[model samples]
Target: MSDTGRRSRILQAAIADGLLHPQRAPLAAFMDWERVTSNVQHLMHAFPSHLTTLHAFAVKANSLVPVLTRLRELGMGAEVASNGELTAALRAGFAPERIVFDSPAKSWQELRRALELGVSLNIDNFQELERVRQILSETPSTSEIGIRLNPQVGTGGIAAMSTAGVHSKFGVPLDDPGMREQLIAAYLENPWLRRAHTHVGSQGCPLPLIARGVNELVRFADEVNLRAGFAQVRTLDIGGGLPVDFETDAPIAAFDEYVAELHEGASRLFSGDYAIVTEFGRSILAKHGFIAAYVEYTKQVGGRDIAITHAGAQIATRTVFMPEAWPLRIEGFTESGEAKPTGTAVVQDVAGPCCFAGDLVARGRELPRLVPGDIVTLLDTGAYYASNPFAYNSLPVPGVYGVSMAAGARPEFSVVREAQLDLELTAVATE
Candidate 1:
């Protein structure tokens, strides 16, 4: 079946099962489990046979416990950036050895907990390294330690997503005076620092630029090993930023293209001298998921049609705030979950429920005329949409589900997370 047909069937089944309300303007996120698994397999195939790669799914992209659990089952490790993400990984049954703890501002307690768990650590800055050193003084650890490097690579399409920019706050800048010497001395002084990590950028980052950053990381590692007289850095965590094909029904990320680019630009990385780790967040799950919401009302303003939907800044925070950087495809459907008839295409602005004027998902786009009770499906939303919802207006978090379909078999759906109540803290409130 085509993507549209499968989505229609899943939405119809969700409505029939009472998981989605046809008339209540409810919002829900859905993931194609088969597509997700297929993407993982494709990612695994991109690596060379001689190199050992651990594809750690970045939990910040989609923190749904069931989603993490499923990724773990597919032989993927978890890359957590916060205490909450660490807890989620643990709850999802990811082993400590399979988890990488990385955060720019890891608190004392968070660092302590991570050390106690013996998870891999990618120290962000000198202050963070000091904190880790202090923790190790009190309690010895067996965690794989690494230092994040800002290769000072050129910026990507989005400044905010660029991690290796000259002024980026993510990692220690290698271009700074005495910074390289400091890093080498740190590695020599601490034999436990056996890994090196660098994430060039995310989303809009170019493949060659990302590869260049990885090449710089490899060169740095080689230098450290040469200076230390042994292989002090045995692993390279080339952070993931493989962009998804939002324009097409691509089932997986562009792993083949990305790997080819890396091979061309950073051939040394494939030499098989070091274990490789990837912290891919968006590319792994972005294209496999989407958000479906009801159009509550329609209006005409300044001679242009408008659709007011239950999805806006709450679920599509980046799109609403940065539309150009994160443009999402919108598909219209009738109230009964069938694809809307193709008629005269009208320029409409899809607005969300947020009170601010900037809460629009797509503006000035040519989409079929949307009416009240119609469904609007936001395509390619699996990664950062509902999973990273904005709490503006105290909106409730939408429920998420995983849908799996096999050839000549009935589709199976499992709820990944329940919809949050209007006031989730009501039970704990003592008034």
Candidate 2:
């Protein structure tokens, strides 16, 4: 079935099951389980089985425990940046060895904990490496410690999203004067540093840009090992930056193109000598998830039709704050979950239920006229929309459902996360 058809049925089933209500629960997120499973399966098979590749899901993308648990079940590892993400990974049943600890501002306590747990570590800077060295002197850890390298590969389309820019604050700059010698010396001096890491950017980064960054990482690893007089850098964490297609449901093609680019630009990725780690977050979950909000009211402002929905900065923070960078495809559905008739295309604004004037998700877009009691869906939003919600207007975090829309099967909705209460401190045990 087409993505739109499947989405309509899933929401229809959700409404029938009372998981989505126009009055009581105006906002709810849905993730297609089959689509997510298919995505993971393709990635698992993208490389040869002989090549050691740890596909670690970046926990920052969707921090929900239920989502993490499902990912863990699919034989995917966790790439955690913050201590809270680490805890969430553990709670979701990720093995210690399968978790990778990476963060620019990791506390000493966080480093010690990860080391003790035997999780991999990517030290962001020299100061963090010194602390790790000190900790190792007192207590030996089996952890594979590495340094994050800034490849200076230049920026992608989004300036703020680029992490490998010349002035990026992510990792050690390689192109800076004297830095190559300094980095090689650091690796040679520290035998514990057996890995090198680089994540150029997210979303806006293209496959070619990502491949270039990986090529730099592999080259640096070869240089470091050559200087160390042995295979010192045995692992490479080529951070995930496979851009997703927000315009349509096109994730599998992106991954296929990504593998092709890696083969062309970074063939060393498949070399049998080193183990590979990938921290893909958005690409894994974005295409399979969507946000549905009930349009509470309609109005005409400056001779333009407007739809005020329950979705806004609370659920779609990026869209509300940076609409141009994060443009969302808004679809209209009836209160009963059927597609709203597109008889006449009306150019109008789709506003969210936020007090701010800048909460419009779509500006002067041609779409079916949305009315009160209609549902407005934000497509391709599984990774960051509802999962990375803002506390603006003190809006409650909407419940998220894992939907099964298999062929010839009835649509089913399983609770991935329950709606958050105002005073609730602990997460709901949905899994």
Candidate 3:
């Protein structure tokens, strides 16, 4: 069956099997296991056999325990940015050695935990490096450490998603006066600082800009190694910001294109001198997941059609907050979960259930005329949508299910998370 047909069938079966309740309106985020596995395999194949590459999934994208568990099972590692994410990775059974802790504002307690657990960490600033030094003096432990560098290669389409912008707050600015010399000094001071990391940006970043940023990182590492007269840095953490094609039905991100760009822009990257580490969050899981919501109402205002769905600011926080930067495709379906027939399309705004007027998933998009009780599937939401929900109206968190399908067999679905209940929300406060 075609991709659309197959997805429709899965939704239909989910409804029939009582996995989704139309009354609840917004239900579950569905993950395609097979597609996720294929994407992982494609990334693994892109690297040469001599290079040891760790494709660490950024836990900030989708911190669902089951998702992390599956990624670990696929020989992937975890790149956590917070203590909660580190906890999630550990609970998901990721080995301490396979986890890399990265955060600009990590607390002393968090740093102590990381050191005790023996997970790799990236120091964000010179002050943070001093903190690590203090910790080592007090309680020394074997933990791989690195410094994050900002190549200052220009910003991407979205300024918010740009990590290497002129005024970006992420790694140490490499172009700052005397900053490059200071960074090298830090590495020379601490031989344990054996890794280098750089993440240019994410959704809006261009391929060439990303390549340029990584090339700078490789060059910085090379200089550090040469100046120190020792191969202190053995790994390069080229952070992941591979943009996904939201306008297409492609189930995978452009992994091959990204690798080719890196190879061409930074030929020294694959010299078998250093192992590679990647912190890919969105590109790995974004295309393999989607959100299915119920259209609760339809209205016409000033000659424009509007669909009020259950997937507004709660699930699609970015799309609602910054519509242009995070536009999502909304596919309309009949009340029975079948695809709506092609007809004279109308420009419709898919609004969420939040009280605010800005809680819209899509604005002025042409789609089939939506009606009450219709199903509206939000495409390409696998990464940040459901996993990063905003409790604006205290709406219950939706359930998420991992679905697997084999040829000539029934589709199997397992609950990766359960739908939150009203009482469950208050239970914590009462306790």
Model 3 residue 234 CA deviation in Å: 0.7
The digit string of per-residue lDDT tens for model 2 on 1-431 reads 76787888988898898877886688999988888998999999886789888999999999999999999999999999999999999999999989998899999899999999999999999899889999999999999889999999999988888999999999999899998889899998888799999999998987888899999999999988877889989999998878888997774636677888999999987888789999999999999899999999999988989989999888888888888889999899999999877797799899888888999889999989988999989999999889988888877789999988668788887888997644333344432
Worst 10 residues of 2 by lDDT: 422-431
Alpha-carbon local distance difference test for all models: 0.91, 0.89, 0.89
Rank the candidate models, highest TM-score first.
3, 1, 2
Off by over 4 Å in 3: 423-431
Per-residue lDDT tens digits of candidate 3, residues 1-431? 87777778778878887777776425678999999999988888877878999989999999999999999999899999999999999999999989999888999999999999999999999999999999999998778889999999999999999999878888899999999999999999899999999999999899999999999999999999999898989999999999988888897678889988989998798998889999999899998888998888888989878899888888999989898899888788776779887586888999989998888888889898888888888888889999888888889889999999998567789988887865655597689
> Residue by residue across 1-431, what tens digits does model 1's lDDT show?
77887888888887877667854328999999999999999998988867899999999999989999999999999999999999999999999989999889999999999999999999999999999999999999889999999999889998899999999999899989999999999999988999999999998899999999999999999999999999889999999888778888878788989999999999889887899999999999999998999999999999988999999999999999999989999988887789876686788999999999999999998888999988899999999888988889998888888998887566688989887756645455534
Candidates sorted by lDDT, best first: 1, 3, 2
Q: Give the total clashing residue pairs for model 1.
A: 0
Clashing residue pairs, candidate 1?
none
lDDT value, residue 285 of candidate 1: 93
TM for candidate 3 is: 0.97
What does the lDDT read for residue 51 in candidate 1? 88
Please list the residue runs of candidate 1 whose C-alpha ends up more than 4 Å from where it truly belongs after superposition: 23-25, 424-431
Candidate 2: regions farther than 4 A off = 251-253, 421-431
Compared with the true structure, model 2 gives a TM-score of 0.96
